[model samples]
Target: MFSTFARIRTLYSSTTFTNNTSIFRCIKTIAPSIDQCSNPFSGKGSCGRSVPNDDYFATIHHVSNIVRRDIYLERTLNKMHISRIVNSELVYRVLRSCCQHGIESFRFFNWARTQHPQYDPTTVEFEELLKTLARTAHWETMWKVVQQMKAQNIPISPSIVSFIIEHYGKRGLIDQAVELFNRLKNFGCSQTTEVYNAMLFALCEVKNFQGAYALIRRMIRKGTVPDKLTYSILVNGWCSAGKMREAQEFLEEMSRKGFNPPVRGRDLLIDGLLSAGYLESAKGLVRKMTKEGFVPDVGTFNSLAEAVCKTGEIDFCIDLFNDVCRLGLCPDTETYKIVITAAAKAGRIDEAFQILHRSIEAGHRPFPSLYAPILKAFFRRGQFDDAFSFFSDMKVKGHPPNRPLYTMLIKMCCRGGRFVEASNYLVEMTELNLLPMSRSFDTVTDGLKNCGKHDLAKRIEQLEISVKGI
Candidate 1:
């Protein structure tokens, strides 16, 4: 029911585009009227300033929406009145956005080619379209695109083949993936390490570990030096299959063969266990590593802490943090963020404050994210005065709160029936040259009126009108 590039000649020959001045007039309206609402910085006010419209993003968004929704895509798109000729970047962006709908993307691509001024779809557009088709399992259409690429003299790169092979593996089309892997040379694409890794991942996806191991050996023999990802892939695969012993042995065997990974195999194991949802095993391994005084990499430790915290084990994560600190692993901001957020959410505001102080002592500047949780915790406990004091202190001492933090504070104030305070924050935002969300204005306006502060509400309305240029 859908048209491909093979039908482009017939489609283009029958269709005609008019330079109707009315059509061009409609183009302005199509350039996204919601730009003002979606981007608060796109209006004529003190707070909301205008910026030049981004034509590429606007065109891609418009074309993608049409392609995704319209069944008769070519017909609907032919009626589109773009003010300027479509470029290669615009074609690629539109194709990328319509990735899940291969046929419609193809139809749109063909339609783009038919546009006046001879729009030539470049290699980039073709490559992105091929990936879109492959990802959507439109194998027939994907092959058609490959043939088109060949005819256009655009050689397929190994990276493109690698992407397709990985997607094939994801979809469990193992045999097809293998066939493509074996035929890369025929496609004039070399067997790069990326291709090997992609093929290895496909084999591993199907639990063909024996085959994956054989391929690794073949990869080494072919003089393609394996990278960290090459080793990590097999380790993660083995861990996923519950073959922990085999995963460890394989890493050791590779190391003994002079193929030592850049990072430690044990770190990979913990990561693999974590990724495979073996949380308890990951925790046990961390404990064992800490006992032997082997300080886990900071990144690995942070990952473990974050994962454990998500399982509502905040206390356990805190203990783990203490253990790692003792091992001289200085926690990064992310480490503090994870713990602070968890502690605040768990109502341990005191503990959250302690972590925030530690972060500051370590010379890390407190951002809104680091401190917002504590504010929220104070509000949750009805410590409104404390939250206000904390906000004031942050403004005077640390990085000034950004637009989002002010928005959060304003909403929280309205929810607590502190309409006057919320209105004050709204005005403060304008003073700081930050554009507040339109809904923030509505909230404060309504709240003030409800509390019989109609005078204050009217002033806020006039301020909003000035800021929004309404």
Candidate 2:
């Protein structure tokens, strides 16, 4: 038997053994039958992408479970024929799936490299394992992985470095983050726009505004073009610290230097304020924009409206909606959905109806989600007649109720003690070839029997048995 587990020990002997002894022991124990390994998921479409079959997923689940739970993983895995099917994508996915079991994941990663030449790991696999190690704070092992990457002559990208830096900053290891940022060249990665943005984010996380500002200036002086994200990071940072005026100044200064953001400066400021929970400031900015006839980006308007609506300011959102529309801002379906949902929740049904009509007039088809909340509001107000009429109207207008809608209607009917209506809807669902939930059947039948509608209860029970084939 060409055992993968037996070869893993030799592979480790040839490589540096900086990892713990237990990981080595785990590696030595894995014995896969690589001679019989075959690529069952070798089918490909015209695009040349591997189309994985069910066996691929089963193998993935099997291997991940073994890595996660099996005490003798090598012995268990050695019996499986998985060597040829192992690729970088599979390795990345398995690593991601074993997210909480970092050490075991490492053991599996090491074991995988010894499976076959076909299972040679790539940069994707390395990056994923590095992320797993970093996220689990396995620093020594992470650096050893970096050395392995170096030994393989794979140049580390700035993006992965930035990821590590961000994690370092999050853990308040700012010094480590700065040190890594300073050593980009040693890792053979250029200090690109993405790396600079990440460093700025880290600096701002610790409220080091002055250092962040200097870093951006250094980035610019070094002739690296600042992307929109670079500007947003600083602006958002300032707003988060309640320094709106400084944020505005930074934007203005950047604009003067010919680095205007892709969007309007005020839009960024308002969005930053909203993100920072300075709702009143964000609202104040919107009010100013409304008066100045400046049409904020529809996205900015949507964010502002949605944030305010969450605070029970639907009336204000309504007014803001009208003002922005008058200013020639075309609201997307999401904008209307936000206002309608907020209005419905606040019992402003008429307002919600008006918005829905407008949305329909604008050629937006009313989906179930777009209209379900209105039905819920009507039910809450005990307007059973109106709710039923509205549902019928929606059906007539070409929006057929889905299974979930029927299920919801049935549930609501049962809750309201309208057993007759519930039975009627249950029958309608069967006629439409929709299978009502077992719980729905039980609830309606129980409610019907309690209301002395014994025949209807028997009919519902028969329908349940017929649909479920029980």
Q: State which candidate has the highest lDDT.
A: 1
For every model shown, what is its TM-score relative to the native structure? 0.84, 0.81
Worst 10 residues of 1 by lDDT: 1-10
Candidate with best TM-score: 1
Candidate 1: give the clashing pairs. Answer: none
Whole-model Cα lDDT of every candidate shown, in order:
0.81, 0.80
Residue 52, model 2: lDDT of 29
TM-score of 1: 0.84
Which segments of model 1 are wrong by more than 4 Å? 1-24, 28-58, 81-84, 114-117, 445-452
lDDT of 1 by residue, 1-470 (tens): 11222222232122222222221134545333322223322232311212234443455677789999988877776677652435555577688888899888888887877763545667788989989998889989899989888788788999999999999999999999999999877678999999999999999899999999999999999999999889889999999989999999999999899999878989999988988999999999999998999888888888898899889999988888878888898889898999899899999998889888889899998999889999988888888889989998877767889999999999899889988778778767776778788899999999989989887787777777766655
Can you give the lDDT of residue 173 in candidate 1? 95
Show model 2 residue runs off by greater than 4 Å: 1-59, 62-89, 115-118, 396-400, 427-435
